[model samples]
Target: MLFLTSRLDHTDEEVFKIKQLRQLVEKCDELCVGTDDTMLTKFLHYTRWDTIKAYQAIHAYYEFKRRHPTWLARHSIEHYRPLFYGTHCRFVMPHVDRDGRVLVIFKTVDGFQRFPDYLQSLVEMDDLIFESLLLLPRVQEKGITVICDLQGTTRNFLRQFSPAFMKVVNEKNGVLPFSQRIVHIIQRGFLMHVTSTLFMPFMNKEFKERIFTHDGRHLSKLREMVGYESLPAEYGGPASNVLDTDLIFNHLLQNADYLEKLQKYEKL
Candidate 1:
């Protein structure tokens, strides 16, 4: 169970986004961020919350992960996002285990709630998010993935992604690859957007391309790919909830097609 996140929201806006993130990551059962302890202290030492919330964020993720230790199989957490207006993006992607949690955070936020108002609240108040949800024991859970997009981007790409995303933004369609930040914020919202990409490989592909094209210097984009839902809920897993799967389909949409393809590939 690989865990990834994007710190698109620079504003300290909500709590549920992070908490809801906890809920979604229940699959990991052992939350870990994308950074080392030294860096984490340096990053949050200057913040207003005095890094209390920062510590909470880490503990929250770990506690959530601890709940279902058996569910996690492959997990990575990318920290940070590429900012067009400012490189000092306040939305610290945090120190994740895999280092990719930042991007995963961004991907989750954009795909889920479409970056709704509720999501921002989570970032502002981390515990509220957990409070909002009716959580059950690890023994009782649902097969669902919940992501919160605290950052907002109203980009035109939401309407017209390439076959890798929407099928209308392909080079043949005459839609140029405009600056995604400009388009996503204008179309989605400066600090709000959400959706699911498990069943949406095109979206994930385009997202990776954006990382490679926009922030390649600071961040490294992976040439390889993996999608959730293709994994078994119980393979190499603990006897936790089916919802506590090693493979987590983030945000909103599930990757039925990706799952199907994985099966075919396995057979071949």
Candidate 2:
């Protein structure tokens, strides 16, 4: 999870805006907003440097944590660990896309029959991964791109991803600091239709607009969207870019401290 952060030199105007944002956030004692420059910069980055929008986003973020204390308190990496040993349900890619946005690849291989707590596990993983991605300035600036490979997915698996669950996820997505640039769903015909119908109701306008569906038959568009080098071998990228559980586990382990801190923040 550790990557070198480039020294970002903000313009005088940008610095002033961040200072303004910091002052505004600090004044609100109820909001557990950190005044770190880098963190504030990320807020500004995602909100397109609009100070008011960034402040609102920051407020919404802390407020969500404050309201969902019980939910956040139970967040654990252990819940998501089972996926790695067998199904490899979800993992962030080793490289960024053409726009320098982080790529998060999700697979439905083997389904989640073994894990009854899959929903909670997915929630914790989302929080952990987004928190990790926010550490990189490039990711903060460019947002994230998601590729959902539903190649081996089953009807039983789709069954678990109910509309109610998607509603909760969508609400969480709204408050998270990082942006989701797009979602590429790899499925077709009836299965794709079912999946789309299940989640579309919960998606925000921007999120819905950002989605790009692709059938398994043709991935040329996906390749063009994210660049061939950015994808894994299963999607027609280099074999070296194939999914590696060890690499993913190593990254998560390295960020163990942050996850601990995140649990603490969740309790707040």
Candidate 3:
């Protein structure tokens, strides 16, 4: 099969021959390719963004595919969520912090501009989305949905009040707060599709326990899965987050057997 491994700075594909997949922990960073009398596939991605630029890295893929139609017609880029994040994905799995501030991420098509009117209608549902969806049409296939969480409860509450305050102005003299103005120009389709992210936590057990607890009260299906151990192998869970792309890619480059298969093929 054809295997493609994408990271922050570059993307490469190769043909993996199981023969090349050595049995060693250190080879993890390598992408491998192999066939069991079946189809060829390319998968695996590694990326990290500090804040806003993170969304850009995700968006780049979408734009890349859009700009190159010929490449797309023949090959389908399967946007993946790390298996530990599991297959039960949500199109708009919005999360709010314990403090009540909501994070809005924009990637596929920023600030809702690409969405249709129906979807746009939902954006104005301020109560539902404390934060915005960072959209970037160009990177939809890259399997990235940016991370944005509310700053805190006080800040989020202030944001809510600013709108009504603006309406008072619009009524008196047609002036609106900058936040309200941004909301008014909002596009419609950002939340139309149910999506989720494939994330690998960088912290160790103590760190994960602490951070995961902050938002435990507002549990999401994705969060539940992430917080729990992988389902037993016979049940279809992907063995463990250790083998899953998100954590494996995030935690270490010690082994690259997965990338070994790709090398066997000439084209990577």
TM-score, every prediction: 0.18, 0.86, 0.17
Q: Which candidate is the best by TM-score?
A: 2
Candidate 1 TM-score to native = 0.18
Put down candidate 2 lDDT per residue, 1-268, tens digits, no spaces. 3254554588999989989999998887666646777678778887889999998888777677776653452545655676666666667777888888888887766545676766555556656766766777777777889898776666876777877668776877787777556889898677766877788789999778988888888999999999999899889888888786666666667777665565664213
How do the candidates rank by TM-score, highest first?
2, 1, 3
Candidate 3 lDDT over 1-268, as tens digits, reads 0012232332222222211222221233332223321111111111221222322322343333344322211211121122113321112212222222222232122222323331222222221111111111112123222122321112222323344433332232111011111110111222221111111122234323322211312334423333223322212223432222332222212223322232232211
Q: lDDT (0-100) at residue 203 of candidate 2?
A: 90
Candidate 2 CA-lDDT value: 0.74
Extract clashing residue pairs from model 2: none
Worst ten in a row by lDDT for model 3 = 175-184
lDDT of 1: 0.25
Candidate lDDT scores, in order, read 0.25, 0.74, 0.23
